[model samples]
Target chain A: MSPTREEIAKLASSPAHEARLLCRHNLVDTTSGLAGDYVQANLVILPSAYADDFRMLCARNPVPCPILGATPVGNPKRIIPDACISSDKDDFDIRTDFPCYHVFSTIESDGKKKVIIEKKTNLLNDWTDDHIGFLIGCSFSFEQALSQRGLRLCHQEDNKVVAMYQTKIPLLPAGIFHGSGFVVSMRTFQPEEVELVRDITRPYLAAHGEPVAWGWDGAQSIGVEDINKVNYGDAQTIREGEIPVFWGCGVTPQFAVEKALERDAIKGTVMSHQPGRMLVTDWKIVDFLKYTQEQLGLSR
Target chain B: MSPTREEIAKLASSPAHEARLLCRHNLVDTTSGLAGDYVQANLVILPSAYADDFRMLCARNPVPCPILGATPVGNPKRIIPDACISSDKDDFDIRTDFPCYHVFSTIESDGKKKVIIEKKTNLLNDWTDDHIGFLIGCSFSFEQALSQRGLRLCHQEDNKVVAMYQTKIPLLPAGIFHGSGFVVSMRTFQPEEVELVRDITRPYLAAHGEPVAWGWDGAQSIGVEDINKVNYGDAQTIREGEIPVFWGCGVTPQFAVEKALERDAIKGTVMSHQPGRMLVTDWKIVDFLKYTQEQLGLSR
Candidate 1:
């Protein structure tokens, strides 16, 4: 059964408790709207061999892959003070934090390597000593920030997943991770509200920050062929006087992995949390904004 | 002979003429005071074979090696409209534009690779089709902004080169670019005036933006020991009521190259403009600020 808003708000208030419930009992299938005050992260796990290249990919394409933190090789436990809940718990395991994980393996088939995706509840059995994990910033924190400012999100109102599309924007190639196009998530807003939405979300640099582009025809500029059909997630209808705003999506790294597998640049497995089943962290939204402000030299 | 402030101011008012004077005629060796309004760049030239790795290094270490523009492989000319001066003239060549160039070669000695620096007028005879040029943003633009805001720079007032030091802060490693320490340029200011200087210079992100550290203890935080000595340039005295402020220096890439050569990551030659001698580009200081503001989503 779907939890009520009050239940979600209670969970949001105590992220550590919520994480225990989700990780231990598998109480939630999707992390959306739960722990709204804290930062939720997208997960990407790979063998240590590809860690350097992946790091380069994240550094080069920061907008799409703003890394909150990364675990050292072979370390399943992440300990970032005030940034992650896992740091507080001794038994915190990345392999089972999320409700579901999508394990992708690069297999040689028909003279070419192909990536095959398999859904798993947890990676406890699949975890290896050579694996490294990366926790990337997600749009959830910024969405909560928007809601706090009274901005209406169409996806939440409609009870559907946010619309995601793969755009023609070429990501800056780094190392063996190249040639994959950029991906973006769309949120439609009234024409008059677009600027305000941008202003509110601009400070969350770790959470993909501000909208990359906005307008009725914004998707076309980034090479989105049709709004009705999305590469991932559900598509929302554009009402009268509504414009679609696009922000760099966390799903970008997954696409890059697929592209890398195709090019034989990556030969091992790549795993990630299922869409919307993010790793809820202990970090407050304000912390990220403060860090971004300081890094940009906006704060004294 | 060092040009006087009046002569440099006259040249600063006309960058195209100044560039011609510097390129065609044997003019001033240091480009510090010339072209105050325009952006000055530090030049790094390398073979196309190392272009990808070098680009990755710059992207990974943006504050230390903020790239303004890069020429295509084998292209001696850089034509970035309104971003660089080389675009304005057909004869503008990266090989001869600067007053002096430091050509570095990686040579094997005692079974270890060592980098040797040689000063030259131009790479006209050494220029090859396989070489690529990178024009990096220098702190000159932000220094001008600080001056415009009535901030007094100790190095400028004393007519000494900006004091530079190699900090223990290790740069984020990219492919073939690891273990190199970060480098910073220092300027001393009165304790009360430091905040104003940071506020004025923070907008120029293309140039090294803001002071990374300040005060006598600032250097130690980033891993530099002893303020009395420096790695490069002239040392300035920290006054009784003043504190030292350090910003990321352009010399970082050269240090990285040396490190890479030591590790045998780079087997080819690396060339750069001599310290204080820079490429005076056509881009205005305001343009860089606007670009930075836009990139950070600070503007509409």
Candidate 2:
């Protein structure tokens, strides 16, 4: 039997492990509202040979691809002993903890490369001992903080996936992960409320920090031709006088993988969380922000 | 011919290209005083196979291994056309531009790995098409900014190389570059002047911004047993009431290379700039700081 609305709402405030269990059982379709206080991550898994280059790509373009933590080679368990974060002791499994995963594979025949993407309920069949997983910071990790400060996210109000778009801004190329552009998540805020929103989001550095651009002019500057259409997720209502603010999105690596496959740069399988469905990690947002601040030497 | 003191002083304020030419001729022993307004870089060159791991290692340890820029595979000419920083148009050659280079090769026989470090005037003899060079930011980039505010550095005052130490602080390892610890450069400051000194250096994010540790207790915490005995550079006098302040050093990568070789992780040669002898690039320090601020989304 399917869970009722009341049952799902109760799961929204549940602990991270409970939410993860829901995902493991394939009972949760989207992790956006579940475990609202815990950290949510975008998953990207690749062969160990390609892991270093992907890590560098994320490092070079930190705004678009902030890494919360990475799993050791052949290890799917989410445990970072020295991170001092809440997630260090969780009985987590990367392959089965997410509701859905997208797998991409490339085939080279007669000097031509073709990419095939397939959807799966879990990654158990595709995972290998030579693979490494990266948990990239997701914008959803900061949504709770915004709501606590009286800011209403358009997607949550409408019960839709956050709107994501591919932009003209190019990421710094690293190794074979080259020729990719930036991807951003969009939200509409009143002109007067934009500054307060920026102030609140600036502290969540791991969650893409402040908006990279805002206003109608801002959207055009990043080369988003149509605000009504998005590359991923659902579009939200843009009320009159409400400008769209764009923050770097974690979907960037997915786009990067596609671009790399198009250029024949990758020859193996790549896996990622389906957009809007994230891995509910044991980390608390506050702890992640504090850890990031200390790493950047911004802490007192 | 050896240049006079007055000529060397004049060369300090000269353009970056002129200073690079001096180093190209092996006329300058060290790049500390030359090109005061320009950026100086620590060089690390390795085979293409090891490039990704090294780059990821640097990314994971940003405080100790901030990358200024990287050269395209097999390209020794320093030209980053789209980097908007001052270095794009200069005729800079990485192999012959530094005063000296250190060549490290590993020999494996009978299941034993032996690392040999050799000194050379240039890298032309050993460099091949498979080599990719990385230019890392050096602390010297911020010394001018500190001096501009009337804060004198101890090493400069004594006309000695900055003291560097291998610390007990382990680095976040990546791929083959595992089991390495941090390396820090030391300087002494009066107790009251440390805060102001930190504020001046903090803005140079790419140049290993701010002190990682300070004072005598801070020294012991990082496992620096004796401040007077140095590992890579000369030690300066620590006056009474003054304490030693430590900054993340670029030498960490070299130490990382040593540790990796010791573990039988690397089987080929590694090339690096001789300590205190850096690559004087076309990039101005001011431009690099501004670019870094914009990238971090901290620019207004």
Candidate 3:
């Protein structure tokens, strides 16, 4: 059965500590369709100065790079008085919670043309006071939005990955971190309902409104041409009247970080699970704001 | 000079009689950047039955179709007693907002495609007692978020159209009305700032978070493979050390609506503007929500 608001709330409020531990221990591998209603995220940890720039970047770009919480300088859990919830009160450690980890290192002597992107394991030991843990929001939230709207998720049906592509769309960069553009994820829907789908999701982009494009033939779709060959997941079948829509993906930053992963920019930390897995905070946005409200003594 | 908060307030809070004048005499033109504080939306007047399904779709997807207000069947103004924003003093007609209009004829059929994907400009005379007007949030709101965050908009800077892309993502489909997946708009920023950009915007999309991808090597960025040949809008330059960031754009629905038009899903209606330009309302989100005290709601 699908998780309910009540069950999800309980998990967020209590036992979530164990829940994350369970996931980390591989006791719970698929957070994919579980412990929902709580916010999940994409994790990217880096050094402090880069952390500062990255934080600003998330601030500038927002939507994807949501920082759930940040650890203090050299401290694993930089305690924020009010987190989403208190149940499994986050020890605020980026070192754990995440079941999987990808530690990245940049090679100094590699020629620009011969550059290769590689990843290792976790980086708990080489911790620097400058390290920053950034938790980003995912399309998973949109998945919830879709489910609420009764839109069937094809990936669930096909038991496949959400089709993602590298779009020509460029992204905002900061500091020495000159990065490339985003690799957007795409989903298909009937052409007729395109507006209906757009109307429903756009405002949901935090009132920014949704979708950058729709209805255009997919064959010619590319911000920077020839990028279609690269993909993170397999593509799905496009129906007779189906129109493909593209969204900015979280991989945008990882690509950016890769470019900026200079020796000075060199820093490492554990990577979070796929976009589906999130650290359910004890706080719902409404309640999260309400809690912040009480803390600030908001009279109303 | 840029409009001030007080000036904007004065204009937004002006009596309906005067606000209507802005509509008349084509005064609302040069609306390129007006009332950035509030929402401006596309106005679509349609028959009531189609309105029902559209409403269902909107309700199903509140993110893109945030129903700020609606007009009664016979009411020329949306400030109807039974309307959503009945108390909003900005009660005005949708007829005059846009500089142009397009009327759809159910009989105007080109059997070739049986549907079309273009904006309708006029059809007020065809309005029946059963017509309804839809008010949706637009990209102007997020432009505020972007402009305030120091993420310079290439559009605003060059006085050009925002770069957009048509991609593989699809919108969620609805009855007679198909939906879209993710639509992305492009913006550029340096790499390190990417995280901050994402962080700032995450809370807003707490429901969905933000962009799906971030990339570094343009080739690997977006997981796709392209940029030069875009789906829409002119391409901009990426400076020596900058990365491009993508976000959800309001045009997602426009494509859907056009596709619907082409398909005759429900004779498209064109009253004024696109979905994202929200009608500046009497209430601001910050004033209504108490959580914006920090950083004065700018996320600085």
Candidate 4:
């Protein structure tokens, strides 16, 4: 069930620590519209053996797989504070922070490898010392930025998921992780406002930056077969004179991981956040940008 | 001795593939002024045991350690092409291509640990499968950009090494790598031209971005106690009305590795490119920026 506008506003204004408690206790079903000013990150946890290759994959495809930071080998506790959502909370555990998780694995049946997914509320039981948790930048950060600029998001207004599609755009292959293309989230903007939207969103490079494609031709260029049907998330209303705009999605790595598992490239379980549900962080979008610019040498 | 002006111009116009050949055959002692239109990189090699930690350290302090790309584990050949200087050459060997290298190690003497640096022309004998080669962005890329904008570099004109100093600015520590600050490369510009220089260099985020500090007070703020006495490279002439402008140097990781060795953080030999000698590559600075923008989500 979607929250009332008043409730949404209340959630948006809540401190990150309080919002985390709600999610940690399973009181919140989804992180959307919650802690609106705070940075929300997509979470991916991988075993130590595959960590380096995964890091390289993220490096290779930074738009879809922008890395916020990761845990050290065998350590579930995040030592680096800036990359983390909660800078002041030393006890923030990746295993129990997010609202939900999707665990992916592969099994052999009739001499064919098949992928399987299991959903969970937390990761306390599934985690191990060999696992490293990585936080990836989410479009929610830019969505918030866009919202502040008076650009209305139809999905948010109607209480639906941001439409996502698996495009034919091939990702740069990394070790044991290949054969997956980009997964882009779709939004709609009028033709006249498209350039303005691009200008506003381009600064959030860590949050997937500007739109990759827009308009009917843009959608076709990326090879989106059906506009109404989405691979993940729910489709939103498309007003007349408005065109669908696509931004690189965080679900990209998840799809890549699934592909790797199907190819038997990953030997162990891979965990990721359920779409739309994220780990709300203490960092604001502007502050995170400053952190990246000063510490990571990435400036607008 | 430095090359003559005609020789410098000829070297600058030479193709990256030819420049690499010159270095590979030991025909060139330094990469400076060679393949001026191409990208040059600083190399760092570490055992797999320490690569992840070192990678994290680089991530934590990116201005001083911007990663262009890295060789896969146990692979001496750089598989990633776009990050390579010779993007068209698949056989860009890390062990043999660089003009010079500095091998860092530790030894215990009189009950105290001491760090030692050894100079080598190649890594044929020292390299093993356990090593991972990382290509870090060098200041040379941005220096070329500055030169193109009519901002003359004193060191380049006089054929002197860019003066570098160890600064007191602390770096964020990672596993088994800590206790080191930043190393900055200094150039001089007139007081009125400092802002213009900053505007020019800011776009080269991979090449240490804009100046971290400028002017006499800027140098003092970063803890350059004696500007004339440089810690590495030659000190160039500081003309009247010109102020020292500092950018994060590639030597930073070298200093960090030395500090780690002193603290017994690293167990095996570490390798890096010698100051002033770089690995020339096929990528031009403008094209490299576009690659980062498209692939790495870093746009100017």
Candidate 5:
């Protein structure tokens, strides 16, 4: 069954530590929706052979594909365990906690494994030791951050997906993976409130927060008319005399994965979140500082 | 004539604000080559009738149309002056600072107006009490910031112009003006340095900073492949393995202005930085708090 909003909101507002337990105890179906205060990451399950290229792509394009963590070859229990997930997939019983898992059978063709994973899947026994897991940052972190200011997400109001679009913008290609920049969902407000909203979200870009773009200044998508007509989610309402603002979204990884479809083998059984919910963890948003890599002694 | 790089860069890094003083004195054709430390801004000389809508557009899209400062109706100087040139566009001299001005007699029609005069001409005659001048942020700030980081701007390195592309991403239509997202020049980097580049740049998006987008991500009208085939500047050696990183560029306003061309309007001429260096101000990069009107307690 599809998830409900209240259930998702409840899960999102819950404490991160508790949220992890829900996923760990097999009480949730892919903590896609439960943690509102935290970041939701897209997961990619690949073989160790493809790991290096994927890692470089993340390094090359961190925004659309930030590396939250990844399991070591043959070990599913930890991926930057000190900072990322508390434990490995098996430890949390992820197979059940996630609403479902998509099982992929890599068919080798030519020198490369021809990736033919489609929308159809059942819990097959193909999951194995060769499987490597990767967690990518979600665009929802910005949405959750924005929600703290009492702004209403259109999806919350309409029970629809966030409006997303396919843009002419291309994603940085990594080994076997290429992504296209998609349409950013836009929210409109009265002309007077443009700066108000831009100001509210500036802190998240950097501790040195600055508004990237605003109004016509920041609204660098296709024109609003085309954007409104083409949407991945329901369009939001704009009061008379209001302008629209857009932000870089988290769905970027999805784009990244799609771009790689022809070349790379992608087997991601994305964990689902409760409606309005995401996985809230003990992770502090600021702790993911670029400067702290040395402190953490982690190699990129 | 357009400004040269060595001349522009020298003027920019110079301790003397003479380039501005020359423009202020109605001494130069345009201030394009005069200073480098500060940001160059586009001057929108609008009548009151078009002011509100234009303001809304700028506020909605801050990056493409950043509003650095604006004057009260009939006032030539704004409270916060454009940091690129001297604050005194009205009193100092607009006629000569720019190589030439594209006068739109009626901002609504994008109608052309006859050139009133040139450098050494009295702008006091054209600067009427009914006119309001608005200064919008230009790209020079980021360009200079990038050059300072040792990243060779392709245009300067290859002695070519920075390439621009029109994108499927469109701007929100505001009143009579319409525009699309920009296709900016790309810079290739070693895959690893992307984060460092983005971080050092965080403070400049607003007064503080903004996030950087990777060019290789599709649909943004830029990518590593496009780096070679269609660039504004002469393509440089990306070094066998550098990944190209892209940023939301100032050139966005150039496209916005171009699309708004179908109508007669209060348009700011494209003030392409002729190697236009910004007028570095007393503002230290660190003190940049990314303040908004609300944060400053000035907004109602």
Candidate 6:
């Protein structure tokens, strides 16, 4: 029998074990709220031919695509040992860690380019020696941090994906990865909670950091035309006194990949973890704090 | 008549004016103590073929080589308009702004590859359409900050170049720019003032940040074999009750360039600003503080 939601939550306390359970059961749902306190990452796997440009892309658009770790070409193991797990019985595998994978392929149909997305349990048959994997920071890390401070996330309470939208702000272009604008995810909070939310999220620099914009007025500053209409994820109703807060979203890279395909800049297949299905790593929320401490030379 | 030191100091209060004066008179002396409160940079110009690898090198080894700005290929003007010069000049020529430049050439002799350094007033004849300029952060910015807080740098008092040493700590490799180790500049301070010094310098992330290691034992931790055998600059005596603190030095990238040439990873000339002849930028010391403020979302 499959594990219950409560059992999954309990198993999530141990990220490695939780990832194993999800992989073994081949669960296709989102990984949100599963591995509490541990770092969950958005995965992007590309052919080695496009690796350098994609690395530059992440470096140029750090806010939306903060790279936590990258594997060498043809390597499937995590950069850090046991950072991601496939199953309880097998070694950590990038192909099967996440609940589902989205494989994107560009095809020529009727003298026009069309993108086809295929959902698969793993990339076992699709894996190649020339593939490289990039694990990027997810805003879920900071969302958990905000929740700990008593700032309730409306989407989690309502059991829906956070609303995401494309913005007018253009990302700094690098190499062939150009022309794609910034994408953001939105949440609503009481007006009084904005400062506290910013304070709580700013420390997680690897995870998109603080809100790019707050309130409807601030949203328009970044050229968000409508709060109800979103480019990705489910839109939630804004309460009477709640303000709309926007943050750099992990979905931005997927959009950039699509843009690259449109321009014929990328020729091979590009793979990403399904929107809510993330690769759970061994890193804790406090690891970012530790990095800051080390940077400041406070720790031995 | 030549301007007095006081006149030059006063003139340096404005970076643009100082740059023009330096360019016109060809003042090839150390720029230290001239431009107070302004940021100084180490300049490196390479051919377009090697620009991407060099950029990756800077990204991978940020501590030793924090990039302040990079000019687009074939562009001699600063990346930010009027950011690096005083408009009071006849030209915004990068070739003649500093005291001197070091042009490195690779030569093969006796079945061994060797590097020859040539000192030039500018790269006037050497400038080409394929050259890209990289301005790296210099420690002088934070050193000035430390001086403001009553930390006396001994070498500055004696009018000598700061002592520098090459270490066994290998830098994170990027493409052809690999195999070079870290180089550090050492400063001595009384044991009681170590923490305060660390605290003051930690905020200047762009200018090498805090000390990588402190004291005699700490120096050994990073693989400094001997203190007396200096690699690049003048060595100062360690007074009783004083501890030696080491910080990342800008000289590292120059050393890396030489290493690259030795292995033939780099072809063609590599140009760099002569030691102590830095490119003064229009940025204030406090600009870095503002960056931190913005990163933390405290200034929004």
Number of the top-ranking candidate, with DockQ as the measure: 3
Model 1 lDDT tens row, A1-300:
755545644654366546644644467765667778778888899888876557646654676788777766777876434346643465467888777888988777899988888899888877788888888888877888788788778888888778888875555445567657668889988889876887677667678766766785666767777888988778887788788988878888888888888888765667888776788777878777777655543322
Give me the displacement of residue B217 in model 6, in angstroms: 1.5
Q: Candidate 6 lDDT, tens digit per residue, B1-300?
A: 866546765765466456545643566466666566777788888887877567656654566788888776787755533454544433555777767889988788888789888989878888788888888888888888788889888778878778888875555444466556778889999988987887687556677766766788777866777887888777887778888888878888888888888888776678988776777777777877677545422212
Clashing pairs in 2: none
Query: Which whole-number lDDT from 0 to 100 does residue A46 have in model 2?
Result: 82
lDDT minimum window of 10 residues, candidate 6 chain B: B291-300
The candidate 5 chain B region of ten consecutive residues with least summed lDDT is B270-279
lDDT of 4 by residue, A1-300 (tens): 644544544654347866776676667765667778787788889887887567656765667788887777667667344545454466477787787889887779888789888999888888888888888888888787778888989788888878899986655455567667889989999998887887677556677766767789878867897899998889788988889988888889999888888778777678998887788877777776676555433223
Off by over 4 Å in 4: A1-300, B1-14, B79-91, B293-300
In order of appearance, the predictions have TM-scores of 0.54, 0.54, 0.53, 0.53, 0.45, 0.54
| Docking verdict class for candidate 6 | incorrect
Alpha-carbon lDDT of model 6 = 0.73
By TM-score, how accurate is candidate 1?
0.54
In model 1, what lDDT does residue A39 have? 86
C-alpha-based local distance difference test score of model 5: 0.47
lDDT tens string, model 6, A182-208?
Answer: 788888999999878876775566777
Q: B1-300, model 3: which lDDT tens digit per residue?
A: 434444544655343233334543344432335555443444556666665555544443433344445666656556332432323445455655444444543345545444323343333454556677665544544556667887766666766555666543444344455634445556677788777776655433311224444544532444334655455555666666777666554445555555566566764343434322224443343332233224212223
Residue A185, candidate 6: C-alpha displacement in angstroms = 32
* lDDT score for candidate 4 against the true structure: 0.76
What is model 5's DockQ versus the real complex? 0.03
Best by lDDT: 2
Please compute DockQ, using alpha carbons, for every candidate against the native two-chain complex.
Answer: 0.02, 0.02, 0.04, 0.03, 0.03, 0.02
Measured by TM-score, how close is model 2 to the native structure? 0.54
> Docking category for candidate 2?
incorrect
